[model samples]
Target: MPASIVEEFWRTQFATEPYRGGGFALTANPTLEEDRRAMLLVAADGTETAVVSPALAGVTATDAASFRAASAEAGARLHDPDLVHYLAADDRIGEETGHDIRLLTSADEDAFAAFEAGASEQDLDDAYVELDHWAVVGAFDGDELVCAASAYPWDDTQLADLGVLTLESHRGRGIARRVVRALAGEIIARGYEPQYRCQVDNAASIALARRAGFEVYGTWEPVSPDQ
Candidate 1:
């Protein structure tokens, strides 16, 4: 698919990443917060573009230059800077380790609540409650939830972005991989492509995506206000 089409889908459906060729295409959305608005696009031919809305653009004279500087500073603060990876599903060859994986719904509130109780971070819980295009699959060991994966609509087209979480006690096992595979399978069966995104420094997540047959195609990093 052309990168332009992908950009359109992301912009219209997800209200983000409004990329057009080597430039940015602005779209009006009253709900977008000025401080949280920014876009970064790295094209296949090595061309790149970074855009900030008019409200935030004045903070820096050049969006691309400011974004690059921010990314460099972020990298110095940590082992790796924040990055968004574009991934596509390829093949599925991992064994299904017999963990029961089930889709979550409003009826699964109790199970979700239990899973939330063990959550190490808040993003999953916040997305679960707020996103309308969200879908979740949880992996269970006997009666306990060990890991879960969730996908949210990525664009107006057939694309979904996914995240996975495995309880601290279950890190080494393949539960994360299994849950992601199951979630990706469902997303594909529903006629959408699954996109796996994670921080570049998250080795466990990167390995899980690879184990589940996803390959990285592109990377993006945004400029934060503090930077």
Candidate 2:
């Protein structure tokens, strides 16, 4: 695999080496606010780091267990970890699914709204793809938008994070594979790295990432939404 952009992105955030070279580094996350967010970032090399906001930084240490305990004490519970994948440029394997996936724009507003309206709330939240987002792409089923993808730069990094949604009635048709390939290719052509993230429990997303040429980079346990 090419050098992991995952490492490069987090490095600037920590203001120090986030990688422990197979160890742990519990550090304060400058970007987070107190009592707002706390979580863990595990690098591909087995390096674990407890990323807590500055306020809670004093309560944790270089121990992963202690970091978890501290986070719980701060009234924040660990959420489901997200499996992270970086697009493997040299290893990009392609497939032909007979879907004419293309880049979409604001002109496709009505179609995207109709597609979004057809998706359930759960699906909408899970996919997180939006038509008005930074970049949009999709495929049509005859005249209906059956599936779409969108991306945004991850933090301030060159990594373009990806989200893909397939119409509930149109999954299992290989639209996802083609859509992802098209979007990732677009991101690459724009001179940015592509990153795919999904909950570890999402079997379908995991499978699609692999088949679409994304390599597992690491797992991130970000703070759960405030409830």
Candidate 3:
């Protein structure tokens, strides 16, 4: 990825309280989280391979046959009665039901505060800090921020990145769509490509990406145990 784009992605991830305990991790980081998480689960008697950070808990099988069997068993177990949503990502799934745009600013700490109040700890579990590379646009209803979209980290190698959100109370309306388009336009104006990712099973997010002219590049699993 281009250094600029890469830098921006990290910035947005760390911002808005979305990233809490888990810090920035690249796939090739010498100290891989997958290796670490696998070691933690060593007593389970399972072969291990690496999945990316923050998702799949970084557990796969070292042995192909054993891995396949374990994957099947894991899939079955994931669907069992106890686990609801075995692996979840902050995939930007839900829709905006009904709200007007209030356009937020950095000075509007109250909006961030409200956003923090309405946000889940899991939603806030990323760890990134600098955001000099990207720009942002937010949607608010009155003083309450119902949705937000940010554009940052654009350059030659990495695709431009966007981060978007809609409050839980706001769904089904075109609020998310509007904010996304607004953010995408901003990203284009800044001269970088835009890339988006969501959980494999998240229909709403997949639909939104397609609607916004994004194709599935690939899937990236997050691997922060704290998340």
Of candidate 3, the 10-residue stretch with the lowest lDDT total is 79-88
- Using lDDT as the measure, the top candidate is 2
Clashes of 3: 23
Candidate No. with top TM-score: 2
Global lDDT for candidate 2?
0.79
Q: Candidate 3 — which residues are off by over 4 angstroms?
A: 1-103, 126-133, 154-158, 220-227
**Per-model lDDT:** 0.59, 0.79, 0.45
What tens-digit string does per-residue lDDT give for candidate 3 at 39-120? 1111012212222224433435544334334434433111111101111122232333345543355676777667767866
* Cand. 1 TM to true fold: 0.64
**How far is 177's C-alpha from truth in model 2 (Å)?**
1.0
**Ordering by TM-score:** 2, 1, 3
lDDT tens string, model 1, 191-211?
667777666676776777778
lDDT of 3: 0.45
* Candidate 2 collision pairs: none
Residue 64 local lDDT, model 1: 50
RMSD (CA, Å), each prediction: 6.4, 2.7, 12.3
- Candidate 1 minimal-lDDT segment of 10 residues: 74-83
